[model samples]
Target: MTTAYCFDLDGTLTRQELLPLIASSVGLEDEISVLTEATISGVLPFDKSFKLRVRLLRDAKLDWIHAALSEQVEFDRHILDFIASRPEQCFVVTGNLDIWVKPVLDRLGIQSFTSTARLDDGRLDGIAHILHKGDAVSSLRDRFERIIAVGDGMNDVPMFEAADWRIAFGGTHSPNRLLVKLSDFVINDGNALCRLLNML
Candidate 1:
């Protein structure tokens, strides 16, 4: 079987969820976090929710977002090693902005699909779209015979459904119960994820 791997960035591949860091960088943490929670709870559509949250952080400095994300996010070492061993089969599929996730992706040497960061005058204009993660997986579908998806959020559920195998990670965030239920295999650590992938 051709095993194609797709991963969610925040709270799955990375140790921290980037949205809260971006929110905290601009002093909108409390307010924006509510929106985030609401989205996860399925109270609002992801695209509309993301746009609203991004607007709150629109004036944030690119440096602040980059620095905060770099400081807070760390790659799961086991996943890192596994990806290095089989570089061609893995890719990061995240809803987080690519600009904010640059450091981690570079270190791991992986291709990722994420929301675009729009810049008007060298400042973040806003998130270009939400539910961006689903689009990424759809694009990759035709190229792979068996797609394996992993994630921990409501936004991730759609992409997870498209995969031949799905994992719900609980190493970082408290994942939605629905995500865990849909997953074919559920794991909480990087080593465990690697083990499952190796067997498959």
Candidate 2:
């Protein structure tokens, strides 16, 4: 039977979040930072807020951002190795754009479900679609006998609820108490992430 493991990208996979870096890449730090704050605070809806940020930085060169993102994104390497040991079942399910997370995802060689953006004249035109992450997991459940999800943000709660096992990574976001209350497992350290995965 196939088992599926879905992971969030931002704080779950990196020491720093992607949007702020994408903003800084093109000197739109002020605007994106506000959107990031609003997103985390629930001031703005996640998808609309994220789209606004992307549009603001639409002129950024995807290549430059990807190269720069390679240098900026960092996270627990050991958890990665743990996933590598069981490659067939692991995947990334994020609200982030695929292009921005491509470098890190490529490095891990994992399949992903993420938002998509359109490009025009070597710049982002806008996000073409938002990946309904929880819906993605719901659909994947038909193919997998068991599904596990790990994440640390408001957007993840829905996916977490759909999982056979749900994990909140406090090492990243300030997880919602409701999510933690429902989680089968909660881990705060990166090394612990491997243990949680192994147990599943």
Compute each candidate's TM-score over C-alphas.
0.90, 0.91
Per-residue accuracy of model 2 over 136-185 as CA lDDT, tens digit each: 89988767999988887767777887888898887766765666877988
Residues 1-200, model 1: lDDT tens digits:
67788988777877877788888888888988888888776677778887887777777777888788777777788988888887888888877676766876787687778778877776677766554666677787678888889888898988987777888888786777888889888888899989999998
Query: lDDT (CA) for every model shown?
Result: 0.80, 0.80
Candidate 1: C-alpha lDDT:
0.80
The clash count of every prediction, one per candidate, is 0, 0
TM-score of 2: 0.91
Root-mean-square deviation per candidate = 1.8, 1.7
| Candidate 1 residue pairs in backbone clash | none
Count steric clashes of candidate 2: 0
Question: Candidate 1: where is the Cα deviation over 4 Å?
Answer: none
